[model samples]
Target: MTKSDPNRILRRLPLAVGGLGAVLLLINRLLTPELTESQARGDVVGVILSAVLILTGLIWQQVQPRSPDIVELIGEEGFVLAQDLPEAVKTELAWASHLLLTNTVTRSLIVYYQGKILLRRGILAAKAEVTPGPILKRVLETQKPIYLVALYVYPGRIEFDYLPENTQGVVCQPIGNQGVLILGANAPRSYTKQDEKWIAGIADKLAVTLQE
Candidate 1:
């Protein structure tokens, strides 16, 4: 069975029990009449149990946990590359960015080198400037990548004005000591471990190409 099968089963269990209880109640009436006080009390108890089960089933279905709906963000779709970049570097940037947008959960990306915004691709925000916030600074200083799962929960998200403001997740992959690869996803907790590793590989490649 699939992962959702368990939830489906749990969801149907109460209804099933209610249905069985209701059927048994009807069957009991045909089998025997509740003429005695004890028999009538037992009948009332069965009716109460059936009602509770049915009510619980209806409530559980409404409150069942489901996947979060990621709203489609409003943004411009394009890439802005700084002029004077070498043709080889530009090609490498384009190829890598394309791969990321197509293959991963990334909905937006920015490539920063030294103090310049070398590339801004995919769904871009209205702003054109990007100042390295504490998170970005930390990544560059320690040369360690940071994955911000569910970007909406982080205060540092305010610094990423260059990416779409409603971006659900982000990956800040440091490129050597002077550059960083910023990837924004369409959904929270969307990127897998393998995706992060592949992104690091691409960032390394960009570092080599940009420096050359």
Candidate 2:
């Protein structure tokens, strides 16, 4: 979509309202009341009509798609993680427990580290997948994040130790670049460009922490 000049719209709104007011005044005078008491109805109609025109003019001026702000979204999601996982992982099982709880995306999230699903968090109760190692390894190689919305992962979504039902959204980021940050939503295509940007920001933060 083409970008809009916000400054131009801001300038036009007042002019549009002034024009609407003039038109409403003309109508109120031209359509005189039959009875003196009915003049109240004209006043009411004028107010309602003026309100509708002003609203219509304002909406017509500011209808455009804007770019998603990624950094802001990252800041919001990162807060969720920092609050959930403040401590370092001691045991692999404990690490898995942390992953499941910290990750709000899927009903469960499995983290594959060092050729194993090191953590599992969420509702699914199944044995680790048969091919998690290869799947995660491939995801690690891609160096980009994957978003899964509405419980369905992409055609080649990395295999997890267990499949999660109602897995609305999935984001797979390579640990090397940034630990994968998956944010889930129930509706399909719920992940917008803004979400990707936010996830990327979170991944970048994780990368810095990992490097340090």
Which candidate number has the best TM-score? 1
lDDT scores for all predictions?
0.88, 0.49
Model 2 misplaced stretches (Cα beyond 4 Å) = 1-87, 90-107, 125-130, 133-135, 149-161, 177-184, 204-212
Question: Could you give candidate 1's per-residue lDDT for residues 58-119 as a string of tens digits?
Answer: 88887755654576766989988988898888899999999999888898999998989999
For each candidate in turn, give its C-alpha RMSD to the true structure in angstroms.
4.7, 10.3
Instruction: Report the lDDT tens digits of candidate 2 across residue range 1-212.
Output: 23457577665675587577768677766786554667767666766767776776677666654543221111111111222332554233344335434443333444443444434444543454435344445566777665544334355533542444334455566656423433333345545576566556554644454455
Q: How accurate is candidate 1 locally (lDDT)?
A: 0.88
* Candidate 1 Cα errors over 4 Å, as ranges: 1-68
The top-ranked prediction according to lDDT is 1
lDDT over C-alpha atoms for residue 114 of model 1: 96
